[model samples]
Target: MTRISQTTRLEKVEHIVGSGSGLLDFAVKGENGYDTWEGNEDADWTVEDVDSVQNVEEDRYIMYPEGDYFICEIEADTEERNSGPVRCWCE
Candidate 1:
């Protein structure tokens, strides 16, 4: 007989944009190390994962490790609000 073991690790994360009123679109680097942008129909936003995203604090949001890393791109109506490539380590 053979035995195998596996572990699932999760961490907290936050999405920070220059200027935005609501949750911005986001994606994460899966364990396989790939960015899956299959978030929304437009592929610009992700469905809210209540379990992962905990709370919203001003310009920052609290999320968990649904993936290895977090990534987001935003196109705001104002130049000051426009931001992109906002990423962070979820591990």
Candidate 2:
């Protein structure tokens, strides 16, 4: 007699960067149910996350299929370089 069943799926992410429009975005929910946007980083702000896009990182970036929480930020609009959209919170 043999019986085996193993299934695992966990995805909860939260990341933010938008104050001065540096660029870095993430917002994933558990069991796949939430999402956010702003990904793509660093247009040359002394290398804040400007590694030519694609998982850019300096302060925070590249968050997918992970686990963690407790991140809050506010300043959704500063006006400069694609100005706007910068608000975050993770729980």
Candidate 3:
């Protein structure tokens, strides 16, 4: 039997916002945090990949109307104020 190897990179990641409808594509962000990776104003603030309401501290994420997802690092963690760069919200 012959074995073939393929490169593993840029997998599609879906970060579900408050609801499970909104998806976040890590392709534009480079997978997970291993590779650090945009943006809107007056847009709604949302969280993705949250395990549970009690576990909101981890897996912090935010999505835009244009389906752009990003890592939202809020200073207070109580507000949607981001302290880091976000995903691309292209319209």
Candidate 4:
């Protein structure tokens, strides 16, 4: 994953899509704490067999051919007008 875990903070947003919606449920990382375990520190998060990013959720950690990555976070835009980019960290 990018060495950006400690640098990036979850931006201020009005409507953040949380870990619910029956999505892939792994360890619940808060907005401030979600940056951990995404780099090369050897994580303790659970693993799921997701084939690709399209089948993943915002809370699930998956092992792919490249490696593992935090689930793509779907959050609202600046004005909560629409969905933002699906973002995640990997190793």
Candidate 5:
């Protein structure tokens, strides 16, 4: 079995609004037939992989199970309330 970990920084977060509130949906790719986990307390989030096989390509993923996560910022709604670019590096 190969252990591969991936992380992705959300793009277009500025265009993604907070709906007059301070929240947004964040997404990450996972592998199918594998168990995955997520948390907000880590500097870099981690997920567990338990797959017999794996395959991945650019700009797409196949997570056996699909889910959604959230991020709540303290910024208010304004023209200048846009956030800076997010950077992600995975190995």
Candidate 6:
């Protein structure tokens, strides 16, 4: 017979909004999944990875690892809105 054991790690991070048009940026290279919130829901928002920044859209984004790690950046049309703490974890 064989036995296996596994463990999970959780990491939480909060990012404050500065002088920008409600833009939030962060890198998620070693996390399993993450969620972002605290922004204008009506305003035009776009979410993109480090590879794509010029794209635009209107939606909320929650990121998950799909075999590769990536840095996500979100931009909103409104400003002065702070991004709440983001929670991420790995299992």
**What is the lDDT for 16 in model 4?**
20
lDDT of 6 by residue, 1-91 (tens): 1111112222322211211243333333343333323343333433223222232345323343322443233332223353322222222
For each of the candidates, give the backbone clash count: 0, 0, 2, 2, 1, 0
Candidate 4 per-residue lDDT, tens place, 1-91, comes to: 1112222233321122233222222233334322222221222223233334322465643334233334444332232222223344433
Error of 6 at 51 (Å): 16
How far off is residue 49 in model 1, in Å?
7.4
Can you tell me which runs of candidate 5 are displaced by over 4 Å? 1-43, 52-57, 65-91
Evaluate residue 59 in candidate 5 and report its C-alpha lDDT on the 0 to 100 scale. Answer: 28
lDDT of 5 by residue, 6-85 (tens): 33333211121112221222333342232112222222232222122123343223322112322212222232323322
Error of 6 at 69 (Å): 1.9
> Model 3: runs farther than 4 Å from truth?
1-11, 14-37, 44-55, 58-91
CA shift at 35, candidate 6, in angstroms?
Answer: 8.4
For residue 44, model 2's alpha carbon misses the true position, in angstroms, by 14
Per-candidate RMSD, Å: 14.2, 14.2, 13.6, 12.9, 15.4, 13.6
Q: Write the per-residue lDDT of candidate 1 for residues 1-91, one digit (tens) a residue.
A: 1111111122232332211343342332333322211112232333233336544556655455455444333233332222222233423
Better of 1 and 3 by TM-score: 1
lDDT of 1: 0.31
- Please give the CA lDDT of all the candidate structures: 0.31, 0.31, 0.30, 0.30, 0.24, 0.30
Which lDDT value does model 1 have at 48? 34
Query: TM-score of every model?
Result: 0.27, 0.27, 0.19, 0.21, 0.17, 0.24
Residue clash pairs of candidate 6: none
Candidate order by lDDT, decreasing, is 1, 2, 4, 6, 3, 5
